[model samples]
Target: MGIVEMNKDGNFPNVRLLFDNDTGIDDALALAYLCACDHVQIEALTSTPGNVDVEQVAANNRALLALCERPEVPILIGAQDPLQIPLVTTPETHGPQGVGYATLPDRGTTASSEADAVDYWIDAARANPGELTVLLTAPLTNFALALRREPRLPWLLRKVVIMGGAFYYQGNTTPTAEWNTHVDPHAAKEVFAAYTAAAEQGLESEKLPIVCSLDTTERFEMQPEFLTRLAEEAGCTESELVLASDPEGTLSNSSNPLVRYLSDALRFYFEFHRHYDQGYIAHVHDYFAAGVAAGTLGYQSRPATVDVETESTLLFGTTVADYRGLWGKPANARIVSSNDPESGFAELLTRLGALARKLDTNS
Candidate 1:
């Protein structure tokens, strides 16, 4: 069964989502999950530099879309670098090409649409006022820029979902920051500031950005056995065994291509986590964020005023959430407080497995 019970009727929620991502391994999984869902309507994809460079990130997005047989969606490239910071990519985490060991198919004719991502953000919001939900799984570069160009975005769009920040939780990028926010602390600061301004201007609470911080996102960890089960669900002839005890860099020999791609990609992630002593499981962060954006994941959120520290040398990218109204600012974000990662991952596997089965049968 899907997350929303209404989805059984076949035409309940027409989630019009605009994805803004850095196109890393987790980002690829997030997009693939949405592609598998029949109800989610992915309008466009915008690329931002984080796990890799802008050009590479755009390429990865096109390749993942093509791999899922979704080439119609236009990809828009954002600023090459953050608003104010040196761009640093984690090749060690996501591999040099940013998609781990998985190889993507050609992006057919072109890579991106003519629309500037920042401009597209403003135009798309104005064209479909209160009808589009923007999903940001990367640094808030394009969003901050868009807010700068169009100050009314907070009220114009239906909603905004962000997969960044650590709040009072442990940071993945630094001692006090998360990866997406750490990449562009200035941009994140500006984005939060924009929402605070909008809240002061009477922006509805429902329209506030839903933030999926690392605390909740880290709960959706991916194990090697999950890939094996996914392969079986995809109707693969061979058993997909990506055991950490086995030789490192072991590739999948599954008959299904989707299974192969996911296995190979996730194996690298598994290895990376093991190297960092986080176990052999991969923390599928963006997948949970994608689920939250689609409204298919059951979660509870609390209103908080979020801000990023961009100046402190020791805590440059730290994200702080004020739940006590101590900052005297209206809440700008609805921070995800709790969720069931088990059911969320189960939902993801079911959807992706069904999609993979359908693709192989159709092909």
Candidate 2:
């Protein structure tokens, strides 16, 4: 299927994206990467509660958009808590504010009280069928609710890229579950089941969701040197230095605002990883997901009949993928199996650095 649309003047193809995330450090990086890309038009942002609370997530998104000079983009708050589960915010992982140590500029509320995220998804899909790609970097809460209201979502949108699950890999949240799915495994299960139902209704297998599980996403690591290179690319007089030897919660003092914001954010991530003995590097899970959604990164995937385990007490949120034909089920997702981390990081640095340089020039 043609994922992008050509301009009316026959110039070039462009992508229209609807972004959903919880606005953690990696999610912020992902959003920044998308904001930097010149070929994609961000239609709107929908915030969900995961890394932090819903209100804080919306504030973080609005602040990031303002920093990117796209504050006019609409933002809607998603489900307050995961269905059938209490809300669990990870301040330990993402700091109290969910953006690590970075400070947000626009702290005003952007949560649309009257508007609902599920309605937004359904309406957007109905209005722009075959022209919208949804990048969901959070729990499957909102999208799952939308699929309940509109079961044809599997065939309505061009693509659905999700950043969750940990098939055949160690989880970051639990021994068998990723954070996003752990927060709302029931929602995930419903999403996959809906897709399976749609497949039975003649939705092509290629239209299934693309799953960016932790097994592949963890490959995209972010070293501190990348930030230094990005600062230099943005023509900052001060190099962005985030040494592991520095104290916890160190801040960035780069000349460029974008570099400084990112430096502060990634510094906390480096510290978090180091605290857990995972080295001073950050596993940029959502940035890879963002690249996958943007169609700017190369990856290999295999079709899998995916399911979520919600009833097991010991395995509360485990994601099970039937790679073999033993399940006798239609494939519900394309599990990303492999990716090149070196090239992914390079692409992120180049695009974000260019945007930073442009912003600096305009300022």
Candidate 3:
């Protein structure tokens, strides 16, 4: 099928994205962008133990959705650790309690007690069959397990857009790999093989998965003016909203302004990155993945046999593709081709600002 066009009524394809997060700032930004889209319908979210604890991730998802006035969205907690490797979280980047140490509002949103991330994914895919697109923004462990449990998942899936694995760009987590895939190399290997097989068999249309790695997303940065405007439109000081989004505020009973600001601003990610890997203010990677899923960001795919090397510490968890002579498939995944981040951020500001204006007028 071609692009799922939004009808006159503004209804688009029903999407079921399974998130494996630890409540990082970019995750919140991505969730906000997803909720803002008019066509895409989010079916559910499954949190994992990557950036923070599973509980904290689930809470952050609910809290952010609530802030967006989308409390109807359901959140489910997923695996506490990867399928193989011991979980290594980036506390400095997301703060101690995830969510960049933002103070979250007192919203008693309950989480679904799914068997596991894998089970939840399997059931959702089986239920939706051939209509659901699985956008994995974190590790592929949950997805790999789900596929193992239900080997026919690819047959049911419409597409699988992942946000892991570095090809042409330097890795954020290591010299050869992205964090999500790096966390569970075994799972990543299985998932890559499964999807590649599906594509070769013509089970899925987009054989080459859309990967919004650091190389592309790092280019899209947030302008300070946009943050200032968002703070103004929210009818509260940016400091206040940031405070409300903090997880530690509820858990540790402490408050910090820098933490709160970091919780909401994707630009501040560099502060943590510099400490961990000598990185700087990168774009909101996951949110841009959502943008691609929504068909706004364009991407070109090169068809090649891709695999994840789970062995060799130097190459472990790294994804590599053999594209010696084959021309890869063209895709709609928009890898930012050196555009003005300030301009791109301005578009976001204007779009959200217009939305705010329309809401105010109706009120």
- TM-scores for all candidates: the values are 0.95, 0.95, 0.78
Q: Per-residue lDDT of 99-154 in model 2, one digit per residue for the tens?
A: 89999766565477424777988899999888899999999888888888998888
Against the reference, the lDDT scores of all candidates come to 0.87, 0.87, 0.62
- Error in Å for residue 66 of model 1: 0.9
lDDT for model 3 comes to 0.62
Summarize candidate 1's per-residue lDDT along 194-240 as a digit string, tens digits: 99999999999899999999978998988889988888788887788
How does residue 331 of candidate 2 score in lDDT? 82
Q: Cα deviation in Å at residue 56, candidate 3?
A: 1.3
What value does the lDDT take at residue 163 in candidate 2?
Answer: 97
State the number of backbone clashes in model 1: 0
Cα RMSDs of all predictions? 2.8, 3.3, 6.0
Candidate 1 minimal-lDDT segment of 10 residues: 1-10
Query: Model 1 segments beyond 4 Å from truth?
Result: 1-12, 112-115
The local lDDT score (0 to 100) that residue 344 gets in candidate 2 is 83
Better of 1 and 3 by lDDT: 1
